[model samples]
Target: MARQVSLATQLAQSPSAWNGHIAPLILRAMTDVYITLAWIFQDREKRTDEYVKYGLGQRKLWLEHFKRSLVERGEKEPEKNLFVKALTRQLNAERFEHITEVNVGAWSERSTRKMAEEAGCLDLYRLAYTPFSTAVHSMWTHIAGYNLRRCRNPLHQFHRVPEDSDLEPDIDYVYRAAKYVAKTFALFDRETGVSVETPSSLDQFVESLAHPTGEAQTDSPDPLDDL
Candidate 1:
């Protein structure tokens, strides 16, 4: 998580040449790191068989998709049946009859959101992780917010800005991402019996960004900040 956040910080600090395109990428990376850490912290013991099952299911799904595409393209001949062989081998290794078995039936109750809830970091998922997901998927929610201009007239008022006029750089986001990384690191450390030691400046930097002097921020502070 620390390394991922560090890379995002570097990208954010670099020239604003790709701010519009890169910011979302950074946000998604941060969100992934946050969720992955939360999962590790919440399921250290046996890591919840469901999570393992979910991962195996994902692998099976991809392999099955690949096999189907190969068959459709007429590339499933005995000599060129690499993907089919791979799928079969994977299923056999996992002791599953087919990909359908891996994907079907009752799944684990523990989801990404559930991990966050169990880890006491659901607010982080709600505030940042979910929004970042839309950005990652290029959903209309992200497109309409960042790409379209707001106007008074309801009809034909929205105009897409030129490529050159992309989003301005936002340093505040970098700070918040860093803070989330720090908190996630602490959570994992505490859960794993490791003492988290942040740099002397980390708390002050996060606080300064969170509450600029003389400005009242309504956002509730992270409880982990006290640590």
Candidate 2:
């Protein structure tokens, strides 16, 4: 949860749309982390050929797009327009031709739910990732939840704005992210033969979050003197 913590810190330091991008990214990464653990727990070698095929297909698709860009610029010879040395050019033409042979598509066939099920994180996916997807997709659900607010008037009117800096998501999501991060780190340590320990403060912080007593109390001995 280093990533989640870092994102939270970033949001606190400088709240903006660019920094807010971290929310969706963190959700996406959580799923990926779980899938990675699943792959590690299972025998990943069984999927080597398929992964390699997927990689090559992705490379070919990228090169095709690059070639199209060159053509649009009216470059007579797209092949000679390569300023940067790319893997597509280095690959044997025969093997590269196999990119066309694979028709499964560039992206993984597995859905987020499938990956989550395999990774044993389907609950987290439903609780966190699915809700976060609304923000990522700019759906009306997110718009209504975050931006729509009632005006302070006797008539009780509603208004929408382009952005809302005061919008803070429920703290439950933060706790969930932290928990995922802790679990991921523990998994990494176990798999890599590392002996890192999570800090006690993380647990304390989560505990404090659950039982908030409002703003911190002042420590001055003469409490009435300041008033």
Top candidate, metric TM-score: 1
Candidate 1, residues 92-170, lDDT tens digits: the string is 7876535434645334445667767876778878888787778778788777776665554568566455232466777
Q: Write down the worst ten-residue block by lDDT for model 1.
A: 97-106
Q: Which candidate number maximizes lDDT?
A: 1
- lDDT by residue (121-155, candidate 2, tens digit) is 68767876777777777788876766565565646
Q: Provide the global lDDT of candidate 1 against the true structure.
A: 0.65
Q: Where does model 2 exceed 4 Å of error?
A: 1-22, 87-108, 148-177, 189-227
User: What value does the lDDT take at residue 106 in candidate 2?
Assistant: 29
Candidate 2 lDDT (Cα, 0 to 1): 0.59
lDDT to native, each model: 0.65, 0.59
